[model samples]
Target: MDINKIHYAEITISAVSPKQYPDDGLPEVALAGRSNVGKSSFINAMVNRKKLARTSGKPGKTRTLNYFNIENELFFVDVPGYGYAKVSNAEQEKWGEMMNVYFSSRDELSLSILLVDLRHHPTELDVQMYDFLKYYNLPVLVVATKADKIKKSKRNKHINQVIQTLELATEDKVMVFSAETREGRDEVWNEILASTRNDSI
Candidate 1:
């Protein structure tokens, strides 16, 4: 977990279904968030690679289940971002179908790292996704991204807003993160390592 050490990371696949997933059974962590919520930037931050995950000024740029191989030990599944109105209804429905099939039954999926903007409350879709993950009984690590944009004095207020909006349980782990400053990167990796290594979470 040394940030300075070199790492092997690449886009293993842009899977659209279970058949396309790697069959080796590596524990997987899925990233979920809004269309412009910085999931890609978060991924790059975690791996200490500036462009490991593609960044876009446009929302809904990521359209498939992108699996990133991290040092050949873990898979970071970047699911398509949700809650963008610019995408067509049919396109959204297609993504919905793709996600429902994957999240509902992907056995290797060990953890879900849900991203929420620290500057605002969790949106309705965000709430629904939390409930969906809960329904599946998966352990969640909620990361409030864009932490650098907020002042330290007012951060707790925004963090509280996220917790309250999601009605996060006491055991749920939540923290502020910044891709720009790499804030919370090590802590997030610690959480991921803990969650992925433990069989019972």
Candidate 2:
């Protein structure tokens, strides 16, 4: 697939606030992951643009639902990364509530990309996120990021661990990607495109 035609069309922050999102026809793919797990970098890499989703070394920088229209066909929703931060307990609870609402009731959401760190196995937060997505019966594409950080021989073991942890059924659902190196960008894009087109809703 030629990805050169892909481009960012628009972006909206705090889209679910004020009222609710309009019933846009465009299929939406939600991105979810633990804080500082390179969620932004994955988006930027998939879109073939730098700084599109605002890469941050610090955790919990993105506190809102960010919507980015891609190639005018699909909307890439960057949901706030969960786990770890200096925020108050109440604030964290608020974030959790907001995320739950979005995940449970978003009509336009077609699929979710659950990003995980390839350097390590799935963390507790990651497992919770997996179960949460599964709980909603939402389709998820697991992206194992930072693949280059680990040795090739050890990569499969870690990936298998993630699959077992998430109780994934299909091996093809796991995507190994390196945002910094632009590796596996096309494969990830293919998965997104496939998910977007599959619209079971």
RMSD of each: 2.1, 2.8
Per-residue CA lDDT of model 2 for 1-201, tens digit only, reads: 347656555675456462556456778889999888898888788777887778776788877788887777888888878887686788788778888888898877888999999888788889888888888988889999999898888978998998988788553388899987888888778777777784221
> Worst 10-residue stretch by lDDT in candidate 2?
13-22
- Candidate 2: clashing pairs of residues: none
Highest lDDT scorer = 1
| Backbone collisions counted per model | 0, 0
lDDT of 1 by residue, 1-201 (tens): 454563798998999888898998889999999989999889888888889898998899888999999887789999989998899999998998998888889988888999999999999999999998888788899999999999999998999999999999787989899999999887888788787775321
Name the candidate that leads on TM-score. Answer: 1
User: What overall lDDT goes with each candidate model?
Assistant: 0.89, 0.81
TM-score for each predicted model, relative to the true structure: 0.95, 0.91
Task: Report the CA-based lDDT of candidate 2 relative to the real structure.
Answer: 0.81
- On a 0 to 100 scale, what is the lDDT of residue 116 in model 1? 97
In angstroms, how far off is 158's CA in candidate 1? 1.1
